[model samples]
Target: MKITIAEYLLKRLKEVNVEHMFGVPGDYNLGFLDYV
Candidate 1:
Protein backbone atom coordinates (compact mmCIF):
# COMPACT_ATOMS: atom_id res chain seq x y z
CA MET A 1 0.00 0.00 0.00
CA LYS A 2 1.26 3.43 -0.90
CA ILE A 3 0.44 6.61 0.98
CA THR A 4 1.26 10.26 0.46
CA ILE A 5 3.48 12.30 2.75
CA ALA A 6 0.43 14.19 3.94
CA GLU A 7 -1.22 10.95 4.98
CA TYR A 8 1.77 9.87 7.00
CA LEU A 9 1.82 13.23 8.75
CA LEU A 10 -1.90 13.21 9.37
CA LYS A 11 -1.61 9.73 10.87
CA ARG A 12 1.08 10.90 13.17
CA LEU A 13 -0.93 13.95 14.14
CA LYS A 14 -3.88 11.68 14.89
CA GLU A 15 -1.77 9.57 17.19
CA VAL A 16 -1.12 12.65 19.28
CA ASN A 17 -4.85 13.39 19.70
CA VAL A 18 -4.95 15.98 17.00
CA GLU A 19 -8.37 16.30 15.42
CA HIS A 20 -7.77 19.41 13.35
CA MET A 21 -4.97 20.50 11.09
CA PHE A 22 -4.54 23.76 9.23
CA GLY A 23 -2.32 24.63 6.34
CA VAL A 24 -2.08 26.70 3.21
CA PRO A 25 -2.85 24.25 0.45
CA GLY A 26 -0.93 24.58 -2.76
CA ASP A 27 -1.23 22.72 -6.05
CA TYR A 28 0.90 19.89 -4.73
CA ASN A 29 -0.99 19.72 -1.45
CA LEU A 30 -4.47 19.87 -2.92
CA GLY A 31 -4.49 16.12 -3.55
CA PHE A 32 -3.55 15.48 0.05
CA LEU A 33 -6.16 17.93 1.29
CA ASP A 34 -8.87 15.83 -0.28
CA TYR A 35 -8.25 13.13 2.29
CA VAL A 36 -8.30 15.59 5.13
Candidate 2:
Protein backbone atom coordinates (compact mmCIF):
# COMPACT_ATOMS: atom_id res chain seq x y z
CA MET A 1 0.00 0.00 0.00
CA LYS A 2 1.12 3.54 -0.66
CA ILE A 3 0.07 6.81 0.93
CA THR A 4 0.55 10.20 -0.67
CA ILE A 5 2.20 13.17 1.02
CA ALA A 6 -1.13 14.91 1.30
CA GLU A 7 -2.64 11.89 3.00
CA TYR A 8 0.24 11.67 5.42
CA LEU A 9 0.06 15.35 6.32
CA LEU A 10 -3.69 15.21 6.84
CA LYS A 11 -3.35 12.19 9.08
CA ARG A 12 -0.68 13.83 11.15
CA LEU A 13 -2.71 16.99 11.50
CA LYS A 14 -5.70 14.99 12.64
CA GLU A 15 -3.56 13.17 15.16
CA VAL A 16 -2.52 16.51 16.62
CA ASN A 17 -6.17 17.57 16.80
CA VAL A 18 -5.79 20.27 14.23
CA GLU A 19 -9.16 21.70 13.34
CA HIS A 20 -8.36 24.29 10.74
CA MET A 21 -5.84 24.89 7.98
CA PHE A 22 -5.72 28.48 6.83
CA GLY A 23 -4.18 29.62 3.58
CA VAL A 24 -4.84 31.36 0.34
CA PRO A 25 -6.41 29.30 -2.42
CA GLY A 26 -4.12 29.65 -5.39
CA ASP A 27 -3.37 27.68 -8.53
CA TYR A 28 -0.26 26.06 -7.11
CA ASN A 29 -1.87 24.71 -3.94
CA LEU A 30 -5.54 24.78 -4.77
CA GLY A 31 -5.61 20.99 -5.04
CA PHE A 32 -3.72 20.37 -1.84
CA LEU A 33 -5.69 23.13 -0.13
CA ASP A 34 -8.85 21.17 -0.71
CA TYR A 35 -7.57 18.54 1.71
CA VAL A 36 -7.16 21.25 4.30
Candidate 3:
Protein backbone atom coordinates (compact mmCIF):
# COMPACT_ATOMS: atom_id res chain seq x y z
CA MET A 1 0.00 0.00 0.00
CA LYS A 2 1.13 3.55 -0.67
CA ILE A 3 0.57 6.41 1.75
CA THR A 4 0.77 10.14 1.19
CA ILE A 5 3.33 12.27 3.02
CA ALA A 6 0.80 13.74 5.42
CA GLU A 7 -0.65 10.36 6.31
CA TYR A 8 2.81 8.89 6.77
CA LEU A 9 3.86 11.68 9.10
CA LEU A 10 0.72 11.46 11.22
CA LYS A 11 1.15 7.71 11.55
CA ARG A 12 4.76 8.11 12.60
CA LEU A 13 3.81 10.69 15.18
CA LYS A 14 1.15 8.38 16.55
CA GLU A 15 3.54 5.44 16.65
CA VAL A 16 6.00 7.58 18.66
CA ASN A 17 3.18 8.58 21.01
CA VAL A 18 3.59 12.29 20.37
CA GLU A 19 0.56 13.65 22.14
CA HIS A 20 1.63 17.26 22.18
CA MET A 21 3.90 19.26 19.92
CA PHE A 22 5.22 22.63 21.08
CA GLY A 23 6.46 25.58 19.08
CA VAL A 24 6.50 29.35 19.12
CA PRO A 25 4.47 31.41 16.62
CA GLY A 26 6.61 32.40 13.64
CA ASP A 27 6.23 32.83 9.89
CA TYR A 28 8.03 29.68 8.75
CA ASN A 29 6.98 27.32 11.55
CA LEU A 30 3.46 28.73 11.97
CA GLY A 31 1.89 26.46 9.37
CA PHE A 32 3.73 23.37 10.61
CA LEU A 33 2.95 24.18 14.26
CA ASP A 34 -0.68 24.81 13.41
CA TYR A 35 -0.93 21.46 11.67
CA VAL A 36 0.42 19.78 14.84
Candidate 4:
Protein backbone atom coordinates (compact mmCIF):
# COMPACT_ATOMS: atom_id res chain seq x y z
CA MET A 1 0.00 0.00 0.00
CA LYS A 2 3.01 2.26 -0.09
CA ILE A 3 2.81 5.01 -2.73
CA THR A 4 5.04 7.95 -3.55
CA ILE A 5 3.78 11.54 -3.55
CA ALA A 6 4.25 11.72 -7.27
CA GLU A 7 2.13 8.63 -7.79
CA TYR A 8 -0.61 10.01 -5.59
CA LEU A 9 -0.62 13.35 -7.36
CA LEU A 10 -0.79 11.88 -10.87
CA LYS A 11 -3.63 9.60 -9.81
CA ARG A 12 -5.61 12.54 -8.49
CA LEU A 13 -4.94 14.54 -11.61
CA LYS A 14 -6.29 11.71 -13.73
CA GLU A 15 -9.42 11.49 -11.57
CA VAL A 16 -10.11 15.16 -12.35
CA ASN A 17 -9.69 14.43 -16.11
CA VAL A 18 -6.32 16.07 -16.61
CA GLU A 19 -4.90 14.66 -19.83
CA HIS A 20 -1.82 16.78 -20.22
CA MET A 21 0.49 19.00 -18.23
CA PHE A 22 3.33 21.34 -19.12
CA GLY A 23 6.51 21.85 -17.17
CA VAL A 24 10.24 21.99 -17.54
CA PRO A 25 12.00 18.64 -17.55
CA GLY A 26 14.75 18.64 -14.97
CA ASP A 27 16.22 16.60 -12.15
CA TYR A 28 13.58 17.72 -9.67
CA ASN A 29 10.78 17.05 -12.15
CA LEU A 30 12.06 13.65 -13.21
CA GLY A 31 10.46 11.89 -10.26
CA PHE A 32 7.00 13.23 -11.04
CA LEU A 33 7.41 12.59 -14.75
CA ASP A 34 8.07 8.93 -14.03
CA TYR A 35 4.37 8.57 -13.24
CA VAL A 36 3.40 10.09 -16.55
TM-score to native of every candidate shown = 0.59, 0.76, 0.50, 0.82
Residue 2 lDDT in model 3?
Answer: 90
Alpha carbon lDDT of each predicted model: 0.86, 0.84, 0.71, 0.90
Q: How well does candidate 2 score on lDDT at residue 32?
A: 80
Which predicted model would earn the best TM-score?
4
Q: Candidate 2 vs. truth: CA RMSD?
A: 1.2
Candidate 1 lDDT, tens digit per residue, 1-36?
998787898889889999877789899888888878
lDDT (Cα, tens digit) per residue for candidate 2, span 1-36: 998788899999999999987887788987787676
Query: Against the hidden true structure, what lDDT does model 1 obtain?
Result: 0.86
User: Which regions of candidate 3 deviate over 4 angstroms?
Assistant: 22-36
Q: Comparing candidate 2 with candidate 4, which one achieves the higher lDDT?
A: 4
Top candidate on lDDT is 4
Scored against the true structure, residue 23 in model 3 reaches a CA lDDT of: 56
RMSD of each: 1.7, 1.2, 3.0, 0.8
Rank the candidate models, highest TM-score first: 4, 2, 1, 3
> Sort by lDDT, best first: what order?
4, 1, 2, 3
Q: In candidate 3, what are the lDDT values of residues 1-36, reduced to their tens digit? A: 996665677789999999986657888765555446
lDDT by residue (tens digit), candidate 4, 1-36: 999999899889999999889999999988788788
